[model samples]
Target: MTYTVNCSILLTELPLLERPAAAKAAGFDAVEFWWPFAEAVPADRDVDAFVNAVRDAGVQLSGLNFFAGDMPAGDRGLVSWVGRESEFKANIAVVAAIGERLGTRAFNALYGNRLEGSSPEAQAELAVENLSAAAQGIAEIGGTVLLEPVSGTPAYPLKTAADALAVIARAKDAGAENIKLLADFYHLAVNGDDVRAVIEDHAKDFGHIQIADNPGRGAPGTGALPLGEWITRSRELGYDGYIGLEYKAPQAEAFTWAIRPVAG
Candidate 1:
């Protein structure tokens, strides 16, 4: 199986426009990222520059995220938020345009965190509506919409693969047939879910997989998670998609572990 770097977390020291080249320089031919722009819908020039940067770097844009609000500020997602439906809708066209330009097939739509007074049923309904719309737009370019289960954030729901798959099922039943799960091992492990069991049971259902070590959300060796084994098991279970290295490493040297062989 091939590996891809998550430029949003790796090479973050560089500007967004330069990350693709940095990832390329690190011997990665494919890269993924969250929404690079601060705005849900950025200016045309900004979009042009971003697209040009990836092309010029000669790396494949394997995956991208729809706008999820300001990530650094703790806004997990916008689509399922009670009042951000319009913002989420505005971002769909922009995300579709970017995916078409970059030939990215996987788009992750984060489910927003629960609100103070919001009903779980209401938020779930909104998620279904927005994700269905996103799936329709992304499907125009033959892309798949991804739903991920994130951990460590109390307000954000969907902490396990089962949780995400349930939502994906709902979206698919609602006419979004291209939706699938983004199985991030780090999040599942952090939430105390059995990573190996998840892969054994549902690897074939995954559209994409992301990885980081638990406890610190750092590079593989920085923490104690059987990342290499999990990766191998995922492939054994028929998941041939990209295994995105979505970890935090402050320096280039931290990636040296990637060259090491996995223990059997």
Candidate 2:
């Protein structure tokens, strides 16, 4: 049972480059992050710095998200943002490069939110095209591209596992089988999905998993999500991917319940 800490959210107290080392010092052998750069295609120096940080810290980059646009500015993803198709495609080589260097084979592609003037149908069609391209690009490194179901944003469309899974099916049917589900338990639960049934019937479709307690999105036991129980059950049901600690809490106290996560 390997747990990967999300340095992006957990170790925000430190500089972005320092978080990996912090996770390593916190007894985690693996780490994951949202798209680390501000742009889809960042400068080579920036890319080199990011790749070197993970390597120098001696922790595996368990997963990385594709450029999801200005996250702090409220942009969720670029996979379907009308005319930004090239930006998403351009970001692929950089993602592949980092994966090749750091042995990362799981990549998250956050689906973009709906635009005011664009038809949902148009955005969805573009999503399939971009995802198909992304899957092919990551496939060169034997990586699986992940489609996640997010919560807290009404405009964000994929709020359930089934929603994300359907998009994955469309992308696969478009000829890229490397696309899979990111099964973030926090989002699934927040979106009011039947989390247990999601796992019971579709654990086989999970390419990765992330966790955070509900109500506050805090550490385990801080809320009423029964996160550890769900994670343990996921393992029993055959999801063997790395479990991501993608919660918000005091860095010093976040991993207090990080010991193999067997609910009791």
**5-55 in candidate 1: lDDT tens per residue?**
898988878888898888777777899989999989999999999999999
Give all TM-scores, in the order shown.
0.96, 0.97
Which residue runs of candidate 1 sit more than 4 Å off their true CA positions? 260-264
Q: In angstroms, how far off is 188's CA in candidate 2?
A: 0.7
For residues 1-264, what per-residue lDDT tens digits would candidate 2 score against the true structure? 688999889989899999998888888889999999999999999989999999999899999999999888889999889988889999999999999999999999999999999999999999999999999998899999999999988889999999998899999899989998998899999999999999998887789999999888998788899887888888898888898989998877878876743222
For model 1, name the residue pairs that clash.
none
Cα distance off (Å), candidate 1, residue 85: 0.9
lDDT of 2 at 186: 92
Candidate 2 ranges beyond 4 A from true positions: 260-264
Report the C-alpha displacement of residue 127, candidate 2, in angstroms: 0.5
